[model samples]
Target: MPEFTRRDIARGVALLGTMATLGDGSPLFAEALDAKTKAALALVNPELLSIARKEAAWRNGPPLTKNYLNIRKQIDGSVAPPLPDIPFAKHSIPVGKGIPDVIIYVINAGGTKRPAILHTHGGGFVLGSARSEIRPKQEMAKALDCTIVTVDYALAPEATYRVSVEQNYAALKWLYDHAATLGVDRKRIAVMGESAGGGHAALLAIVARDRGEVPVMFQCLIYPMLDDRTGSTRMPPPGIGVIGWDVPANVFGWRSFLGQQPGTATVPVTAVPARTKSLAGLPPAFIGVGSIDLFVDEDITYAKRLIDDAVATELHIVPGAFHGFDGAGADTSIAKQFTHAKMNALRRAFGEQSV
Candidate 1:
């Protein structure tokens, strides 16, 4: 992807801010929007409006069930920023007898017994690869002086929730078992991911807790797609899901991953983190989401439930932000602060002094 200089981003934000309607001349929201929702919509950070417009166009595309392959290709074809100079390696570890070996990429800053994170990439569970995240993971490793193991779990419609979740668990097991060899401190292992990946991380934490094989010290969920019911049975307010990652795409993604319609009683509680019975015994968590994002309500409820269960939880609701705003508006001040907060949280989780 082409790099956007500060001037370029500022200019685009300014140009997009003056427009009342989308590029296709459609109203940004429905005419029936409530007074309170209208007020909230007006506060949407102008820097993220450009991304929201693009996401709206994407939402209008062909149904994911019919066009998911092409969409996956588009996501995989996008150019990533140059990889930072760091030690990177790939390995395939056997998950089980019949299950395929899980692939993982390890990005390390090269230190003895350093902190580590097992990260799952976000694509709503059907699109994305660990390779696509190497650059950012390398930068993160360099910045945090840690090692990051990113999993290439199988996608949905082809591979369901059980497959992907088991793949992630296998990766986590491998990370903990080989901690000494990888120069990682096993006691400091954390699980982290964004969007669907965040949901996967949450599930993995539950599995780790129940199985008692590996201990996850922390979980950093970034606007995690935790509840399948968000866009299905339980709809958000009028202005919430209208922007990036709307109801249709969310329902499709969940259905693909769950192998059934979301929000139905048949959906497994283990598959959807929000439906999990208890948050007790789970690791400390940092949950971050945008005020208008589709998953905002579910994420907040999960954090509150965690607190109720006596878990250490830090919840951040970024005002005027939308799903994936950090990536879309990385140069914006809000995005920078959000990233800083996440890193600091991870730092503290790893028992390192916060910057």
Candidate 2:
């Protein structure tokens, strides 16, 4: 029973350190708040609201650039609750020729060959690592009784889109190749991620489909940052603005990761999944996002595309939630329900009886 205080919530959300980039004079995606959004806000749990109020200040401050990279390290380095006492191992595998080794976190609860998860962490593509994602993966490993592997792919501005995607792709191949040794049932493996990692998971699924080598049974994207145009050209619904990572910060991340400004022709289709024309032949997907979060529109459209392409999809839109709602607002009923819904989706996907 790890109870998160208000400060802890702020720090955890701050680990991404991109969502809090909104300033007063900046343009808003929505002219005014929608009735439903307002209602949702009112229904938010009190603890989350308190945390949001305190975290809001970060949005009004100066632009967060590479100079702010240290913020991520500081927050991640801080003391937090201990991870679950689960059996695990760490590995550094080569991605490909002339590339750096990718670090991976492997957690196994012994019994039988079980389902597996290939996880990616969220940091707007500029921050975070496998270490940053341990807690949630630990929870999933225990809850689903599966082996979980969290990938430490290259970050942006240093490693461009090609490097990151290829590294994860190599990691996926490794998982498939070593499934027997890792005690993972080959067909039961799923790709799971939050925020930026969610987008990476989606990309990994596409690559798996294209290569026809690794078979990804499912994709779990939690409040994923899917579209580069989302931070550049997309206009959100009225009253749905500045809740999670701000536009400038979003653009900064996309630019750094893409190695060019988002929405530009230079950004190839392979670099951004939202730019992909066909969603058919992809794995079953679970896409979740907050209504007021910056990614809501892109996430919804992606889900619809998946459905239209006849890909099995489960989309959860939390009415009054903001970015990282479950992480920042973990103590609330809505957050609990939100988290439970994802776990249920996994249970169903893996053919386990619902809890």
Candidate 3:
């Protein structure tokens, strides 16, 4: 665990204070959203809104000020508590060439050969870890009676573009290769991720198709950060950037992951799922995003492409929600609906009769 200084603690306290002031379902703040979006924002989750407010404050400054390490520590601290006390086993898989071994969190699912999910944590690609964001995975494991493996893929600046993708791919392959030992059903494996993890999950599906080794039955992308062009070459819809992962933070995350300025000519298609010309032959997908989220346009666009390619896809756009709302309002009615929809999609993809 990383050590937090007084300043870090104060910043976190200030964030809580700011969130407290926002109150639950503030009508004043709801006006920033569009009419269609406002309906969903009627009962805004204060906890999620707080995260948006913090991001908004960060957006007001130089994006680089939000260091990956610091943000990771703070987010981990916030989520570490309230996480379900689910039993999870950790394992390390070797991915040669001196790169760090991939760390996987295998949640307890009793002693059965059940469907498995290879989860990729969000954080724009530079932040997040399996340990920091284990709640959702825990919930999914218990709800669906499945084993969940969340990957701690290498972060960016240090591990650029292909490294994280290949590492996650390797994790998928390892999970498949050792299915019996891990108590996983090889044919029922799926790739799931949130935010940057969603982008990685999308990439992993592409990689799986290309490699023709491990088969991914489905992909559950929760408001994926798919396009590098987003927040750079592409400007989001009007008023959408008012809260939750504004452009400045988006630019910084992309720059850090790409190891160069984002939206540049040199970025490889392999690194950006949006840059990929084809969405054919990929697995079925479930994509959920909020209308106010910066990634809404890109997520909708990607879902359209998948549909056009004749893939089975489900796209859920929450009216007034923002990025990370599902986590922020996990206990709220809307958040429960969001989660239920996602779990239902996964259950169907896994060929289960009931959710």
Report lDDT (Cα) of residue 24, candidate 2.
38
RMSD of 2: 5.2
For residues 79-114, write the lDDT of model 2, one tens digit per residue: 254375767778888887778889888887355679
Give, for candidate 2, the lowest lDDT window spanning 10 residues: 20-29
For candidate 3, the lDDT comes to 0.74
Cα RMSD (Å) per model? Answer: 5.6, 5.2, 6.6
Q: Candidate 1: TM-score?
A: 0.88
Clashing residue pairs in candidate 2, if any?
19-245, 32-239, 33-239
Each candidate's TM vs. the true structure? 0.88, 0.88, 0.83
List model 3 lDDT by residue over 307-341, tens digit each. Answer: 99998999999877777766644556777889889
- In model 1, what lDDT does residue 171 have? 95
What lDDT does each candidate get?
A: 0.80, 0.77, 0.74
* lDDT by residue (tens digit), candidate 1, 94-132: 989477888999888357999999999887777677887
**Segments of candidate 2 deviating more than 4 angstroms:** 1-11, 14-47, 79-84
- Model 3 earns a TM-score of 0.83
Query: In candidate 2, how many clashes are counted?
Result: 3
Say which prediction, candidate 2 or candidate 3, comes out ahead on TM-score: 2
Q: Which candidate do you rate higher for lDDT, 1 or 3?
A: 1
Worst 10 residues of 1 by lDDT: 11-20
